[model samples]
Target: MNDLEELRDALHTPPGFTPRALDLDAVMTAGGRLRRRRRLATGAGAALAVAALLVGGGQMVGGGAVPDRPGDAPAAARPEVSTPGRPADMLGDPVPTGLPAGTGEYVLYGRTIDDDALPDTTFGMMLAVRGPAGDLTDRVIANEVVGPDTAPGFHAVQGANGPGEPTFGYYVGPATRITAKYSGRTVTAKQARWSADARVIFFWFAPTDGQLKMLTAYDADGKKLPAGHNVVGVG
Candidate 1:
């Protein structure tokens, strides 16, 4: 589904089993009963893992290298093979792609959100900019204040009526309603996962599509922060 749906779903689903220990007999019985499933799952997972490796190395699923799908092919969870910023000694799954490449004032990249917000909303993208464009058509996208730009609150994403432009409704301070719009095709939680770093500014949100999302964040020198101020990281 689209990012909004994914986000909504994540908001509804409650956590399942908590951390616990397994006994030998319990483990043995569970293993025996789940042997076939476990084996099939393992084999399937292995194949997918191999496929991911190949894809990461600039290879495609069927054969030759798969052309980048606007930006959605990588799953935003970091390429399985090799990539910069990916922590070394990372266990099974890769460390997820760090952000996009940019210079001048700021940089933008995609990041994965925690599972709590939205299970399917696994990723978030950010566009870092330093300055504003002369007109709305310019690179920088503007997200109006739902009420305000305050953080640390739950503000459901809404009013992303326009397809190419997505707006964010955030809880500024307390009851303030604020909306931020990014200039790009309709993006979903998965496809729109990007991040910005070092003197960069970013804004993103989801609309109605029921599918995936594809967004691009801009990097501008004017969008950069002060000499020492830290730029917030978003994906």
Candidate 2:
């Protein structure tokens, strides 16, 4: 053995020192406790990181952070677009049960409520959103008024008041494919189920992509559909 190994052996097996019997059970129990502690610490740290992400800025969406203020930085950290998929259950004060529309990174919950006696605003469509972090923000968008037969087509509904906030809206039609144009580039809008009715759908464009110059809806057959009476933007 080398010098270091020889020194370790001498210290471990010193003469005239009778070592206690090995306690395999005790050693295992201590190891288990240590492992449990490590697991708890790891879990706490993960929770803290998620909490910080939510508290630091209220605009994170689509699996990335959104800058709190404009000119801070463009939202390049976010995905190019949220892939359309089944909406996952989001954590909220009163977890929204309405038909949510979004990908894994973000979800949009909307419901048309009509109850004057309700504590919260109980009129028009109540729209709430949740970011990738899995908690719904306090912000909610509600239309003051909506008529019974009002079928507003694709329209610009800004989710929040800043420059880089998301602009989304609902559509009631037979469109299965929706596309929006910005800066002469056409981008497919991410869509999700808004209701049992296939015609009712929710869609949105990426943040900080600038206002959509035009939006077009297409049927499953790829044929362009005529804009509804309440179409928003250039049809």
Candidate 3:
């Protein structure tokens, strides 16, 4: 009905059209060939159009056609003070996970490593929580480090313990502990120990991927605690 549509239909028509009364196979073959040719032309035209758009788009973006307003204009679209030492996040959130079979029996909280860093936290932190009576494995990721749940504290940042203060992993909401350490002579990561309310279990490893040593608390009662034994005790 529209002029543009009518023009398109007219242009597609064969110039020397005829209503033949013979040679059925010949007519069919010719018609099929014409259809194929038309289809090829259409596909080539579409490809050319897409190529043109891509080139034009690259130019528009690269040429700096977009205005640069100082107030809100973006130069380039590129896409945490927890405590003095630990991360600090005040907003409340509940972490979720699918892990060891015993998961979901207890609730989880905190951020996943793949997620954008939570407020006042590291970019690649795996924070979590386990409900009461929940097994640690199914409750937490296979290799994630976790500390015992403690009462909420000011800002959710990892605690700042130093050589002078020698802080242990306790206070909660969000905090970081020396969950891992290098034990080899080279001082590379060979062992680690996450904190709990009970005795610490240090899993010593080797250059190879195998469990070499698992040191349990030698002085649970602190009877022979080395002068500055930084035992892993939690609240």
Candidate 4:
């Protein structure tokens, strides 16, 4: 009791000291402001790091180290052929029926086949007509056949029907003989004409009449080809 009473007297307030109440609301507001500032600084640092990563990724893409995919390969080139022999406007005009001016009763018909695997390339222009005996007749005008390597172009069997008929053209290849059976008669390739570009051979032929049957192409060895090997037929 004596010691506690002495300590209390020593701790007594000095003269003119005033006691004041604490402001709890002001202290809480100041603490909240400090926490918000810390959170803002953390968010800004994270945003800057993400922006740097994106810029680095863009630079890597522009470095050209990426390999080309299969889809990015270039397309194959197309075959080259000569311009059409006849005028475009003269295609469907009717032929005169008589005299020196009259060629024949014919109409223009064109057929083209291009196959790289089979190595068969042909572009033919046929003058077709209905015969007096109710048969279909086809006369060759311009025929172009591409060869394998240094071989000559394709040739056609010449016919006996005069100038307007299909004639034989020239070609060089393993093929030695070409025969066509039409109207109960067999026609064979005769003469050959070299192309202006020298890449192909042209063959003219006489008019083929009656129900057209088949065209058989042969190598120099005279072997009958399989059903569709270099064989041309009416479809």
**Which predicted model would earn the best lDDT?**
2
lDDT against true structure, model 4 = 0.35
lDDT of 4 by residue, 1-235 (tens): 4698787877874657665667755544433322211121123332232233223423322232432233522232111221234433232222322212133244333333222211333433333443444232333333332233224433332232333334333344444565667767887643332333333333333445543235555665897543232223221
The segments of candidate 2 whose C-alpha lies over 4 angstroms from its true place after superposition are 1-105, 115-133, 140-152, 229-235
Which of the two, 1 or 4, has more TM-score?
4
Clash counts for all predictions: 43, 0, 11, 16
- lDDT against the true structure, per candidate, is 0.27, 0.42, 0.25, 0.35
Residue 111: error of model 4 in Å? 14
lDDT of 1 by residue, 140-160 (tens): 112221222223332222222
TM-score of 1: 0.18
Q: Cα lDDT of model 3 overall? A: 0.25
Candidate 1 regions off by >4 Å? 1-55, 61-109, 112-196, 205-235
lDDT of 2 at 73: 26
User: Which residue ranges in model 4 land beyond 4 Å of their true spot?
Assistant: 1-164, 167-172, 197-199, 223-235
- TM-score ranking of the models: 2, 4, 1, 3
TM-score of each: 0.18, 0.43, 0.14, 0.28
Query: Which candidate has the top score in TM-score?
Result: 2
